[model samples]
Target: MESRSKAHVSWCILLEITVAVLFCSNAQAAPLKITLDTYRNCIDGSILSFSVSCCPGVELDLNVTVVDFIPKRDRLSGHRIRKALQCLTGEELRTYTEKLTRAYELMRALPSSDPRSLHQQELTHCAHGTGSFVQDGLKADSNFTLDIHSSWIFLPWHRMFIYFHERILQKLLDDPTFTLHFWNFDNGLDGRTSSTEGCSEPGHFFPGIYNDNSTSTFEPSRSNRTRVLNVPIDLTFPVMFSEADPAVALRCVNEAVPRNREAMHLAMQKGRVSRDFFGIPFRYGDVRPPMLVGGGSLEYFPHNSLHDWVGGFMRTPLRATGDPVFYPAHANVDRLWDVWMKLGDGRELLQPTDPDWLDAEFLLWDENRVLRRLKVKDVLNIADLGYSYEKVYDASWIFWQNSTGLVSSAMAPTQP
Candidate 1:
């Protein structure tokens, strides 16, 4: 009997030791890097199912030096600002809209094969999101697929993607000072716009700049119901309106403002830690399963909700960047990351301090088509990225506390 008990104790110790070794191995994993031969899978297994090659075949200009991303402080015209689209008035609004339209026009005119062209940009998004690319220098039968979504890489990777896109637009315009504008979808409260700090009006509606059919910003494939009926975006999209008819959407629209506030409050309250706010770690050699829900509170909810609401090209990961609204929508997602960092109100919620996360890097083509490598640690500060968002009052949602235990879309309060 004593011998049997001793054997059980030895087995338990061995199991614990094995677990510790596995954890250490994962925690010490290396950062991911991309390569030219990295084949991005083009299979779209979603509702819009299709298969095509998304892999880029362009040969790198090896003669060109690969530059490390250094913030272009000179591009800041007394600090370059990404203003809320709703705030621009008169000449400011007209000029900004015209320039942005012209920039897209120029980008679309580029050859489809050009890495900086609009079509290639769409392909880039597919390569990053659809389990297309894998880690550098891996062998066949390896499962270390490289995707930017559903992990800690989501926020930083998207930020880097847009940064280069803005740069490309600036290059096409020959205007080094041009910056992108963002949609203020989170600020559902009305009177807060009158405040001297952030925006001039409520921005819950889709920005007018993207809706003009004649402009390059317009996308024809999006949902006509929201466009025609003019429904404000439902932040609780996954729960309430993925398949709702227009009547149901309008009914929910009437309650959108309060519900949006509640949704924001809940998303923020849930994001009180690094893993909860940023997402799970995806290190070198990590085999991230496809369609996993590894996104943090903000990424999982509002960021994705807006995408699903936009529908059409914006609906799927494979073709989202084809929609011009995708950029502004993602810009707002990037802005919300900044907002998350400051939500402490003195509590000091922080990002992950792990070296694996801080060291992860990706390759991108700059505005001039120069290849550049960027690291996660380099982009932690927006000011260092040479731009900042207009300050909108988020307090309406920030201070809101959920009283009812309303947890599901079905549980949302409705008025007769």
Candidate 2:
């Protein structure tokens, strides 16, 4: 009996040792996940949206306000600005992004996920409550029903959303240097707009590899068919936004769609441009009144020239929600504006002759009855904004010039 008891004790000890080893191995093997704590350390001076005179080693801790996921009816109708204020506080934004970044990290860590996978999921599942804005209950036509005049609201709304998400990442991972990639179209290397690249299979970067299972359905009309090239970075990536490294940011920028100048020119030449408010479509070519150009009146502004202007006009329900690329496409347009401002000789870019286009009343941020108008020249230098972005292609590569005079639809090889 004594010997049997001793043997049992030995077995139990051995079992405990094996379990300990197994647990340690599993802990070591697990892929690194982006956590809120990790995000905090990555904060850098570049991520601050507003100006700060004094630099501190620790970021300003956010003051968060908890509210319902959606705004209350009274708040939505009665005091929209106040409600917006409730939603737009620093803490709320940080929490929102932290959750989003966590979701992205989870998706990325999955065995077989990629940018394409995330896109398909966004269209079908509405990852960010984007489905709330979908009018037709169809994922494919998400951006189709947006109101044109709501550019004022939509721009701020999306920017706020992005900001909130970024803040959450900063809070979680403790990284401030982590920044976002603004899609640039001015140089025209984006994969989406360029026919030389397969418009349907747009590229993206993942911190790690995963199997891509997303399916693509092709369409003939640019509206009916989704263009994959120049597709925006999936709002979802595995890393917390604050934890994302410069390389990751660069990859996101590099994968964006290139602008299609020919397509844009043809669309404009055909007089398909129109304007709208909120989600409702207005009269074609009548959105903005004639502006003085070279001491004469002109209906169209050179700055607004792009293929999307045509698509923006001809489509009914002028605001687009069905297209996954809409936000990114607009972002690319904004990026081009940023790039052109940088390259167009800073002083010359701000000479606003068009009254409709260059009105002083156009305010980027309005608080306390003080309106701040953003000049075309002021945005020309993003570096002055304390942020610089990576170019689409490497500096060593030859610039892509559309001098062929022939439009060919083929996927071009991506420059490494």
Candidate 3:
């Protein structure tokens, strides 16, 4: 009788554990899938939307080829990994700028109906980012919608977007080796010598390549304050200055470096976890309530703030990508994603394991004007996409010492 009772108790415990596991699995939402029918207008005022479809109607056909991402190692060995350079002054910058401007001039000249055209490229951001889609079975006019921003989707989605955008430029330039460089706006340590040769210097100022009025990279709608020479980009952004007042703006600009360093440190520190860094899960069938604050630390700061700082078209998602400076700006945001994972030796950092996140899919037009489907898991590593960023003085903020002269144990400044 005693043996039988023990057996029954063990069996009951096993059943309970099994049930719990099944329940947890069922609670997770399915992976997101894009369809022509999924498009919608903005459900709230936080992000603007257009009444008309952002995507070109011709590209929405169900019949299209989708090339799955195969590992680069599995492919040909001679393919070069393009290196995206820093925005600082150098011979490299001059060459990159020339190629970039020429490519854009060609891209902009393409008919607006072409998927690779500048207009359509801007619409891609609107379609995916500005509440242009929603969950299945919901009314197009409903108060719930889908946006690539404010969630784990932000990083991977933007990476793929820029990847295709760069590819289009490469096609136009007929140079597969051409790379899309980054605006290193976060590095506020101006005039400091970097430990690595040709790695970086003060890159906080607006990239001059984009400011040249004669180039295709120039956008007149940007803030005039940004054109001021030697005024570093304040990483802390809107919180640091008011453009409305000249005196306060100058004062804030003077104090930008130290404040920027602090902001970068705080953002990285706060984003230690996968959920915190990538943002809350936003899977299929999920209804994003207006109150949901899902943007990760990096996306919220530096990233979004920089968008606002650029002003004009950049301040609005519907028109942000229309500004020529948008691509390089997002390149830095993508670079930081890579940087975030390497922080703390990557022990404490954890990316989402959920299949819903890994398998989330998006549609984009390749350089050939052929529409392709890509998955988040496929772009987890930039190297797989055949690109890498030039090393910069990333340590400036990673080991920053605060006003109190305190440094966290996890990140101690390297001894010179």
Candidate whose lDDT is highest: 1
RMSD of each: 5.5, 27.5, 8.2
Error of 1 at 182 (Å): 0.5
> Candidate 1, residues 1-416: lDDT per residue as tens digits?
99999999999999989845532336448987764445332222221234444654342333455678866542434467888888889999999999999999999999875779888888787777766676753445345666788778899989999988998998898887888999988877765535676674667788889999999999998877447554788766653344644433542445777777877777776445566777777888776534535666777667777776677888777788988898888898899888777776532345878888888878777777777777898888888888999887777688776643443452221100
Deviation (Å) of 338 in candidate 2: 2.2
Q: What's the CA RMSD of model 1 in angstroms?
A: 5.5
**By TM-score, who's the top model here?**
1
Off by over 4 Å in 3: 1-28, 36-53, 58-63, 66-91, 137-144, 190-194, 239-253, 270-272, 289-292, 345-349, 403-416
Q: Positional deviation of 230 in candidate 2, in angstroms? A: 13
- Candidate 2 accuracy as lDDT: 0.26
State in Å the error of residue 230, model 3. Answer: 1.6
Candidate 2 per-residue C-alpha lDDT over 1-416 given as tens digits, one digit per residue, 9 for 90 to 100: 99999999999999989744422222222111112221122221111122111111123221222222211221111210101111123785465344434544543343322222222222211211211222222323323221112222222223333323333333334544434333222332334344342121222321001112131211123321123333333221112123233422322343322223332232122121111111111111222111111111001121222222223221211223232223333444334333333442232333333322222111211111111233322333334333433344211112334433432231111100
Task: Using TM-score, rank the candidates from best to worst.
Answer: 1, 3, 2
- How does model 1 fare in lDDT? 0.72
Question: Model 3 over residues 217-270: C-alpha lDDT tens digits?
Answer: 888998886788767776545522346745325324457777777767766764
Whole-model lDDT per candidate: 0.72, 0.26, 0.69
- Looking at candidate 3, what is the lDDT of residue 164? 84
